[model samples]
Target: MKLKCVAIDDEPLALELVAKFISQTAFLELVSTFENAIEALSFLNQEEVHLVFLDIQMPDLSGMELARILDGKQGKFKPRIIFTTAYNHFAIEGYKVEALDYLLKPFSYEEFFKSATKAFQFFEEKENHLSANIASPSEYIFLKVEYQLIKILLKDIQVIEAYKDYVKVHLQGKTSPILSLTSLKNMEEMLPNDRFMRVHRSFIIGLDHIDAVVRNTVHIGDTVITVSENYKESFMDFLNKWIA
Candidate 1:
C-alpha cells in the first residue's frame, strides 16, 4: 500500500522540493502541503496520514513543538514524524522524540530515499512479524493464581501491569477486570515479543491494544500507563512496530 503523507514547511522552496520528491516516489502519496503548522494540523485532523515531512523552522510553530503537541493527543493514532531541518543541531532532539528519520536541508533525493526506505522497511518488517505472530500464537499458557492455574488465550490479553508482587492482567472481553498475579517475569516469558513489550518495569503492554502514546504516558482507552526511562528504547521500537 502507498504510504499516505503530508509536507509542512514555511519556506515555499523547501515545501516544493519535498512535494516533488514525494511525487516521484510510487510508494508515497503527497496528501497535503502547508506553509504553516496550524494548517497542517487541521489537515491531519480531517484525514489519516501515516507519515509527515516536517520542517523545524516555521513562523507560527516549530516542527518540534508540533511533534510534541501531536504526541500529547489521545489514542493509538499518532502519526510517524520525519523531521526536515536546515540545522544539524536538532538531530539529537528529533531522535529524542522518536522521530522516524531526519533530513538535513539541501539534502539529495538519494539521502531522502534512504531515510524513507528505513521507515518503510521498519513498518513492513513489523507488519509481517505481527501477522505471523497473530496467526501462529502459542497454543495455551497458564497464569499462576496463588493456589490455582488460570488458562487464558494469548490473544485475549490486552496487557499486564505490575505492582510489587502482583501483576494485573488486562483482558480482551468487555468489562473484564484485571487478573491479579504475583509473577511478572513468568508472565512475560510466556508472551511473545512480537505481541507484547515491557515499556516500563511496572507495565508490560500488548502491542495490539495500545491506543496511543503521549510523552511518558501510554494510553489504552481511558487508562494511562507510565513509561520508564529504562524501557524507552524497547518501548519506542514497540511503538513504531506496533503502530505500523
Candidate 2:
C-alpha cells in the first residue's frame, strides 16, 4: 500500500529534496509541500494523509507546536510523523509526540529512505488494524512491513525468535525471516498449540520443523535454539513420545 504523505519545511531546497526522495521511493506518494506550518495544519484538517515529513522549526507555527496540537486530539486516526530538524535537542520532544523517526538536516537519500521505511511500516500496521497480539486463527498470517502485508503460510513457519519488541518469523525455504512488531509471548499464545511449541523464552519452533534435539538444544532449519529449564519438562515429555 502506498502511504500518502506531505512534506513541511520552511526551506524550499530541503522541501524539494524530500519531495524528490518521496517520489523516488515506490511506497510513498507525495501529496503536498508546505513552507508554513500553519498552512500545513490547515491542509491536514481538510485532507486525509497517512504520514508527514515535518520540519521542526517553521515560521508562524513551529512543527513542535503543530505536533502537540495534533496529538492532543482524541481520535482513532492520526498521521505518522517523521521530524526533520537541524537541532538534535528536539529528538526527545519528537518522541513525546510519537514521531516515527528523526532526520537531521544534511541527511542523504540513504538516511531518508531508512526513516521512510519505518514510517511505511507504521502505516501498514495501523491500516491493517493489527495489534501486538493475534485475535483469531487462520491458515495464513499477515505481517505489516515496508507498506505491504506479507502473507506467510502457517505450515511454512520453522522458527520464531524474539528481538526486543519485534519477532522474527523464520520460514522453510527462506533465508531471511519476516519481522513484525510483536512480542514472542504474544505470538506463542496465538500459534496453534499442537503445531507449535515454546522451548525457550525467546524462541518458538514448529513441532513438525524440528530435525533433531541434541543435549539441551533443538534444531530447526539451520538454526539451533536452547531449551530453557522453565520449559524443558514439557519439551522432554513431547520428545519422549517419538523416541521409540
Candidate 3:
C-alpha cells in the first residue's frame, strides 16, 4: 500500500527536494507540500495523511509545535512524523513526541529512503498483525512496545489497566505487567468478548480468573477491581450464570 504523505518546510528548496525524493520512492505517495506549519496543520485536519515529513524550525508555528498538536490529537488519524531539520538539538524533542524517524538537513536520498522504509515497515507490520487477528480469533495477540512486538497469550491476561497513552497488561504468572502504547478501548476490541469483560473505564478483567465477587467489587487474585455502574449490570449478568 502506498503511504499518502505530505512534506512541510519553510524553505522552498528543502520542500522541493523532499517532494522529489518522495516521488523516487515506490511505496510513498506525495499528497501535498506545505511552505508553513500552519497551512500544513489546516490541511492535515481535513486529510487522511499517513506520513508527514516536517521541518523543525519553521516560523510562527514550528514543526515541533505542529508535531505536538498532531500527537495530542485523539482517534486513529495520527500520522507518523519524521522531523527534518539542520539542527541536531531537536532530535531529543522530536523523539519526545514519538516521531517515527529524524532526518538531518542536506540529507541524501539514501537517508530519506531509509527513514521512509522504517515508516513503511511499521505500517506494514501493524496491518499484518491486525489482519491476522481478524482472520482467525487466536489464543494470543501481539502488542507493540517501543520497537518490539511482544506476543501475549489471551489466557495469561489477568487484567488490563489504562494508563494515559499506554495500557498495562497484567499477566497471570508475571510479577510486573507489560506496558504497551495503546488505549484500553483498543484492547477491548482486540480481546475476545466471551473470555474478557470491561468492568470499569480503566479496567478489563479476565472472566475465568475472577476469584470472587463481592457487591460491586471483583477479586482477581490480589487485584480487586471495582465494577463501575455502567458495567455493573453486565458483570452481574455474567455472575448470575454461576449463581446457585
Query: What TM-score against the true fold does each predicted structure earn?
Result: 0.57, 0.55, 0.73
The residue-level lDDT of candidate 3 at 78 comes to: 85
Q: Per-residue CA lDDT of candidate 2, range 1-244, in tens?
A: 9999999999999999999999999999999999999998898888888889999988889999999887665566677788989999998677666677899999999999999988777676654645533565467667644334577788999999998757899989988888876678868877888889999989999999999999999988678999999999999988998685
lDDT for predicted candidate 1 compared with the true structure: 0.78
What is the lDDT ranking, best to worst?
3, 2, 1
Q: Tell me model 3's lDDT, rounded to 2 decimals.
A: 0.91
What C-alpha lDDT values do all the predictions have? 0.78, 0.85, 0.91
lDDT of 3 at 77: 71
Write model 3 residue lDDT over 1-244, tens digit each, in one string: 9999999999999999999999999999999999989999999999899999999988999999999999988886789899999999997677667788899988999999999998998888778877887898778988877644688999999999999778999999999999887789889998989899999999999998999888899999999999999998888888888684
lDDT of 2 at 48: 82
Q: What lDDT is reached at residue 63 by model 2?
A: 95
**How well is each residue in 107-212 modelled by candidate 1, as lDDT tens digits?**
9999989877766765665456556668885544655443234556777777787766578887877576455545678678778887788877777877778788
Candidate 3 TM-score, C-alpha based: 0.73
At residue 85, what lDDT does model 3 achieve? 93
